[model samples]
Target: MDMTGQRTLQVTQQQAWEALNDPDILKACIPGCQRFEPSGDQKFAVAAGIKMGPVSAMFNGSVQLTDIVAPQSYKLNFDAQGGVAGFGKGESSVEIKPLEKGCELHYTVHSSVGGKIAQLGQRLIDGVAKNMAEDFFKRFEAELEKRYPPAEEPIPQQSAPAQTSAGVPVWMWAAGAAVALAVVVMVTR
Candidate 1:
């Protein structure tokens, strides 16, 4: 099966890259992911419980990152076993681009399944994969927001009350006029 999609994340490219490579963040974001830990350089050991149609199983997998470009893109190769349920092996490429407000993540997956999972029909498998991808992104964005909240708009600085040509504030002129009027009123009385 092949799948491709893109998401606009409300985070900087560097922030997105760091979260993607973090084992803790990935584990929390992945649906039914029970374990995700680094095994070696650019490699991780993973276990997740997945249910598709009437079949459910715990998949043990290892993922290795390759073709890495720091804070930009990488290729992931994964292989997993679920005993009688089936096995899945695949490669995916992920790319991150900086957007005006945040960043865009693009991913492509090409994977194959065997054993009973393969017998479940292509449409079912595709639907499950799509749902999993969407779920992952929703969790991922929530995590990002928690880790790096959007910067406040600086509270606008109050702007100094619109300075005049002489560099005096316009509010100062109004205050002077009020004071002069008060002085005239007191003298006339």
Candidate 2:
């Protein structure tokens, strides 16, 4: 099946890019993912449990990230087997663009399936894929918020003139000094 979609992430493109490259973040973000470990550069070992139609299966997969452009885009190649439940292999391209308030993630997926999962019909497979995609991004957004929430604006510090140790304002002292200076200047003139 062919699929395409976009998600607006409440984070900078660079942050989203870094999280995507992090295996731990991806593992946590992926629904039903049990394992996602780096095996080599741009390669990861993946294991996830999923139910498609009525068949529940554990999918062990390899994911390869390629054609990467820092903080912008990458291509993902994935191949997985579910034993009697069949198999799936696919490639997906993801792109991120900085928005006024956040980043927009765009993705395109082209994939195929065979065996029992494929036998479940295209509608079911498509629905499952869509759900997985939505779930992954939803979790990813939450993880990003937890890890790098927007910095709160710092409160302005009060100056001595704004408040005094005693209940009297420091500005009163300054005014008194200024009056004294004026008197001295007038007398000197």
Specify the highest-TM-score model's number. Answer: 1
lDDT of 2 by residue, 15-42 (tens): 8888888878888888788999988888
Clashing pairs in 1: none
- Model 2 regions more than 4 Å off: 153-189
Across 108-134, the per-residue lDDT of candidate 1 in tens digits comes to 999999999999999999999989887
Residue pairs with clashing backbones, model 2: none
Query: Each candidate's root-mean-square deviation in Å?
Result: 16.9, 17.8
Per-model TM-score, in order, reads: 0.81, 0.79
- The CA lDDT of each predicted structure is 0.86, 0.82
